[model samples]
Target: MGSTILPTGMVFASEQNITENSSYSSSDNVGVSIQKDENGDLMVVKTETKARANVARWGAWQYTHIALSTGVTAGAINTAYSKGIGSVLGIFGLPGWAIGNLLTAAGWTNYGNSPGNAVARLWDKNHNGWVGFYKRTGYDGAGRAVATAYKTE
Candidate 1:
């Protein structure tokens, strides 16, 4: 496949042997699409925002790096929020724990919504040096979060 940047700034990947009658569909939430132009060229359109675009396009490498650095299995890390740990603060005793748990319950109404965030948190805590590299490579905390989300998704 090949990629082209549309005038509207959407990045599209293309396949060969497409005809004018070819159909199109988005491959993922990041907006990858396969389309046929008037000239009958088949294309995969990627209209993901900057962060999601990277993850959708280059997730394999990024996720592997996160896994190596965090020393925690991706499956385990992805389920951290659901295992009742991220849901509780528990520092100020019972009342604090109650408030923390309440917020956690509210936040997790839809569990496992974003596994990347959990992995990102672990990376942020355990891999400070790599986090710096990620920043230099244009990944802020939110970008890293999206990267993690992309991995899980």
Candidate 2:
């Protein structure tokens, strides 16, 4: 009779090893106030805007490497339009189209229905508004990679 041997190199830990480098606590006075006007109406009003600044946004573009087959009907054009609009608007609202165009011009093309990725950072100060966009290519299904940050204005 021969004895069988099991493979080695397996290690397991019952608990995770974690270290806390710093802990912070604060003790400060906090207050809240509420006011009502005539007819018991709330005094403060809140409003929202469609587009603002200091928002970091991201978008992906996908162009099919292969063209549509002949005699094959595609879906409604509105679907693609809406998709583009929604993707862009998710970051910059109506101005996303302009930013998208800029990205296309900067080597982010829709060739073969493939789109290049674009990102933008918007900021405003003293009633002045500014938009910055970044475009890149060659991100097809590879493993994780490091991103290099560059300053743009």
List the pairs of residues colliding in candidate 2.
Answer: 63-113, 63-114, 63-115, 64-113
Please report the candidate that would top lDDT against the real structure.
Answer: 1
Residue-level lDDT of model 1, residues 1-153, one tens digit each, is 323333332322334333457533333223433443333422233343655534322232133222233333333323433443332222212222222222221232233555534443433434442321111022333455332211110
In order of appearance, the predictions have TM-scores of 0.18, 0.20
| Candidate 2 lDDT by residue in tens digits, 1-153 | 011111221111121111233211111101111122223311111111222122132123222232221111012112222344333333332222223222222222222232221211111112122332222121213322211111112
Give the best candidate by TM-score: 2
Off by over 4 Å in 1: 1-22, 27-29, 50-153
Q: For model 1, what is the C-alpha lDDT against the true structure?
A: 0.31
Give the Å shift of residue 5 in candidate 1.
20
| Sequence-dependent TM-score of model 2 | 0.20
Per-prediction CA RMSD (Å): 17.0, 24.4
